[model samples]
Target: MQKYSTILLVGVVVILAATLAGVLVFMKNNPAQERALLPLVEIAPMEPDSAKWGVNFPSQWNSLQKTETNNIDTAYAGSSAFSWLERDPRQVILFAGYPFSKDYNDDRGHMNALEDVRATKRLNLNDEDPKRTPATCYSCKSSNNPGLWEEMGMAEYDAMSFNEMTPNINNAIGCSNCHEAGTMRLIVTNPALNEALEAQGKDWTTFTRQEMRTVVCANCHVEYYFDGPGKYLTFPWTNGTRVDQIISYYEEEGFSDWTYPEAGTPMLKAQHPEYEFFTAGSTHYNAGVSCADCHMPYVRDGAAKYSSHDVHSPLINPEQACGQCHTDVNYVVGRVATIQEQVAVTKIAAEDALIDAINAIQLAAANPNADAALLDQARALHRKAQFMWDFLSAENSTGFHNPEYALKICAEATNLARQAQMLAAQSVNDPSLLTTGTYYTTP
Candidate 1:
């Protein structure tokens, strides 16, 4: 019994020593390697200089610089900037009373936001018209916005003229905008986004890590309009993110971007509503996919992996962007193209119907014997039709995010405009108003 006990004790001692030795080796080596892997430089809060943050995250910074390239072109639109009006003259007629008609262009990337705004003829910033553009224009253009918002306060900051606030915007969007200093954790920078989320009874901090991945981009990517006496940036999400819900919110607020030149109806201009559109029960979002999942897919660098920040079309890097879930690359690309084509077709059809409605209304306006009630009905229909069409049109995705929703929106626009046309014809006592005419060419 003593011999057996001695043997067991020896075995136990040997096992424990080996385990201890292994643990000691790991403790000595692992922490040093981990420290070495950490960011070399420290980032400061709201750092205006992206270059400083670049030092700590070279791969991400390097990738971000790729946005400067305007070579890539997709099926419907691309990074290469072009006059939106020239691409389709119908847009000019649609935005006839707004500044967008003056100089709207295809958005390139994050790098170009500031540069594009500066170069755009949208704002006549001469001393003659200092209020040509609002300070809110810089909201999405720079990472320096948060600091400016803090210093000037929301009301004062929003009320300042474009020139008065331009000096405060020193840096274009960068790491500081979407990340916390020191920790480098993702965070929501835009206060307006936070307020918007709060209004929906959502606490931004309560969002999971995966949700934050998309929420970071949602800060600037969603549709918004200037509101109140200060022209403060506000999301049209009081009712909901849906087309009709957003329209209802606008109607309740008595919001009008501009009156249609000929139709004389209030208009609702949609900014890019990608986040709202995609996250509103989209297949991708439902499947736990975030914008960063595709737009900023993880890439490996020897012993390290980091989210690539070359944020542009996911189609540009489908293997890394989409291959994780979608097996067939060609099938996915083909599917997106088909969806876009379908949406485009319906969009044009809707626009044609809307233009006819506008023409009919114009005829009614010119006619002395036009019925007031019928004219009012025509005006209301025009507002609804344009709101639907513009919601899809201004969205940067071109209906790839949610094709069914886009098509439905356009279909509703068409139906409403057709109804408006019939009413306008009755108002003006002209059956020709119900038929197709060269409306864009007329005025």
Candidate 2:
């Protein structure tokens, strides 16, 4: 009887072991289900129309569509497409010779990129003119870029006139602008950004997923210049992304977007440089926070939780945006307001200084008897001062990205402008160039 009971126990143990082994094998062969483990439809690479990609990600697409109509206003910036030129007329004189001075409206949002670019008064639609806008302007305005760039090469694509290239660009920013269709992972979709990263000896592929969130924004939100006759898009990160470093790089290349009218100083027009500003050793960045962390906070819908696709100011949704890191959301929002206001006021001071410098330089240039060498020195200083100021002015964040850095740059810019004005006066042996409040007193 004892031997029979022992035999039954041994048989049960053998059966359980075999079943466990089979379960382990099955689990190894079949992985657990994740968010849409298999696509209901296979998306083609570089699909420009977002609706096709929306088939796989309805929530993100639906959320993204809201940007088209959600034109909310914040204290400094929002999606209302307000004319920045009207809000700050100082920019008019600052950018006098550039197209931006004529028409500089705040961007409506990502969804309206194509429409806004088409409508901007700055665009010279005449294809026959050599100074007309090129297809390079479409670099950040369309989802169709990746495929077009792949087929045509960026050099050839940018070589075409904007009017000539308009037919090919049909979609505004979409999933393909920043994602891989095959894996649905964030990627460096802009070839210019890819090459810039390489120029810095950094590989975007080796970057971690979190890093990609911020770096991906660099695709469109960076300060770039059109290189050479091809009007090829290029980021000025070869020297380093700092404001001073960027000035050095531009000086080395002897590049200027346009010559400041009357002032005769070569000037740089800063494209929105949100990426460079935010990544320049900010507190949030050091804390491992990303641009998307504040701008694209995660929200829950039923059982699904995903980062909200309606990208905008964090002040628009402080609870979901600032509440994630800071315990006091309201306090943080208040801080942003205070910081932005301070920066705005300080920025105006810098602008005033720049105007004075331009005024002095203009006087000096008009004086043929003025020491040519001294006049050239004044022009160089004016160029550096104005570019530094524009870097902060065009950043779009109103200096909240890095308040200390912003103020530091502003102070430096003001000093440079004053020095430029003094040099201009010394060149002509006249103190008239040292006049202040020239803008207020003029016209």
Candidate 3:
């Protein structure tokens, strides 16, 4: 019995030493050498099969699949589709000269990009000048963008027409859109964004992983406009990310996307600025919570761990998302609900103020001798007011991401808008008015 026990002990000691050595080697080699083994694969254009990329990075692909699930809903944004037009028909007058007036729905699943763009009234391919909307429109819609960039170069990618380029943009939003398959690292494939960041004297590559998580969403969720004949994608963050800064930038550039028929203001369209709002909020400001933290919480499947890429409300899985960071689930839920309620109330107030401002502008525009200066004042006020309303509405989770900051920004925006309207009205009432046309009426 003693002889047998001795032999067993010797075998155990040898196994333990070997295991320890193996662990040490793995730790030393993994941070650099192992990462190098993961080569960066440039995905081909219009690679419709997401599963192909899935084989490379199972985790990101698995998370992305959750986007297809339509189970979650919150006060505003969710997995389900919501009609912005039906919610507020006044948008028609606000966006009279834009395609968005005809049809614009709130964002749905990333998977729906191709279908939503196709179905929406924004793109009128049947028109004689289909090129009115350039191929640059597809920049945010799919993984195929990088592939096109590779094949035709950035200049050609921006210059192609939608009708001429639709076939190459068939792939919907997927893994390769945000991740470099070879390295499984996040990459900014949009040349426009790269140039914009560089112009701002910022290196996008230096962004922390947490920042990258939200930056990926910002690639599509921020306010942008096309520049020049190439339809070059551009973010109006030249002046700054703040409302005043962006407005100042546009004014300085003399940029006017369209003129509101009713308001008679050279109006600027505000696209969804989800990342901007979230970044300004308390959670992002204080805790540094990235979008992935709440929107794409982790899920455990057996022994494997993967992020839930549903990209919906954190409320849907509060236990996993909020509860992990917050000890009390009920408190977190209550906070989210309260912030949403406040957002809704503020949204309504801003919308009412905006509509009123629009009405005032239309009335003033009708006078043959209406003051161009006065009209400009009213238009500025309307723009400010509309911007505030759109900012709040665009925030998917209210101030849950940063309650204090979001509330303050919203309040400031609201006050500025109201002030703009008052100034416009004062100008309209003055006798020194010029250049007025027939008053436009809304249906």
Q: In lDDT terms, which candidate is top?
A: 2
* Alpha-carbon deviation at 283 in model 2, angstroms: 0.6
Weakest ten-residue segment in model 1 by summed lDDT: 28-37
User: lDDT per model, in order?
Assistant: 0.83, 0.89, 0.69
Q: Could you estimate the TM-score for every candidate? A: 0.91, 0.92, 0.84
lDDT of 1 by residue, 320-413 (tens): 9888788998899889888998898888888888888888888887888999899989999999898889888888888988778888889999
Off by over 4 Å in 1: 1-39, 126-131, 440-443
Better of 1 and 2 by lDDT: 2
**How well does model 1 score by local distance difference test?**
0.83
Instruction: Give the lowest summed-lDDT range of ten residues in model 3.
Output: 434-443
> Model 2, 1-443: lDDT tens per residue?
99999999999999999999998886554423225547877888999989988887777888899888978999899889899889989989998988888999987778999999999999999888889999999999889999998898989999999999999999999999998897988999899999999999999999998999999999999999999988999999999999988989999999999988887888888888898888889888888999999988887776556778898877888999989888998888889999998999889999999899898889888988999899889999999998899999999999999888899999999999999999999999999889999885432
Per model, state how many residue pairs clash.
0, 0, 9
Instruction: Evaluate model 3: give its lDDT.
Output: 0.69
